[model samples]
Target: MNELVLTLGWLGIYAPMALGAASSAIGCAIAGQASIGAMTETEGGYGRFIGVSAFPSTMVIYGIVIMFTLNRDVTPENAGGLFGIGILSGIALMYCGIWQGRACAAAINATKEKPEIFGLSLAPAAIIEGFGVFAFVFALVISAGIS
Candidate 1:
């Protein structure tokens, strides 16, 4: 049981970054595909599509910050905190990444049809990023409370 607890604690320490990177990769890929499609359809303004596709990459950065914030000596006393914080934050970031990708893809598609609304189309992705930021902030605050 002691070994299991310590192993899980170690898992907790790494989970955020691993999960976050995966989320970002998937999100970026999804949006990037839409970006490519958009580029093929439009004659100009390629930069905005690339920019929108990159929005979901922020989740990976947030995950990195959360992982570092949660990095402390994990003993039996702190294992629960590590696990809860690491896992919960990872899940939140992953969801945010996925949804943010979808949102970005939508933005790219819509803006491809109506170039004038490009900035406005990004609102949903920005809002999704806000949720990821909340999770990141919550993890950091809670991790500070742990020993």
Candidate 2:
């Protein structure tokens, strides 16, 4: 069982980056689709739409950072903590990325209709990003105590 636990510990160490990449891909795709549609409809403000679509990519960066932070010797003593924190934080990042993408898509659509409200439309996506930040910060904080 020690081997199994160590294996899980390794899995946990890398899970954040893997899951965060997946999240970024899904989120970017969703927002990209919306941006593409908006671009075809509106001639101006294509840059903003495209820019917004990239917002979800931050999750991967967060994941990479978390993965680095979590990197260390995996022993039975701390494996459980590593697994729990890494996996849970990864899930949180994934959730945030996916929802943030949808939010960005919504913002794009809204801005497409009323360009004046472009800034306001991004509020939801920003809020979602804030949650991701919270997860990232907390993960770092918690991981510091794991050892």
RMSD of each: 0.7, 0.6
lDDT of 2 at 24: 98
> Residues 1-147, candidate 2, lDDT per residue (tens digit)?
999999989888998899999999999999999999999899798999999999999999999999999999999999999999899999999999999999999999999989999999999999999999999999999999988
Poorly placed runs, candidate 1 (over 4 Å)? none
Give the alpha-carbon lDDT of every model.
Answer: 0.90, 0.95
On residues 1-147, what C-alpha lDDT tens digit does candidate 1 reach at each position? Answer: 988897888788788898899999999999999999999999998998998899989988988988888788889988888988898899999999998999999999999989999889999999999999999998998898889
Q: Judged by lDDT, which candidate is best?
A: 2
Task: Give the Å error, residue 7, model 2.
Answer: 1.1
Q: How far does residue 54 in candidate 2 sit from its true spot (Å)?
A: 0.4
Clashing pairs in 2: none
Model 2 Cα shift for residue 116 (angstroms): 0.5
* Weakest ten-residue segment in model 1 by summed lDDT: 6-15
Every model's TM-score: 0.98, 0.98
> In candidate 2, where is summed lDDT lowest over 10 consecutive residues?
7-16
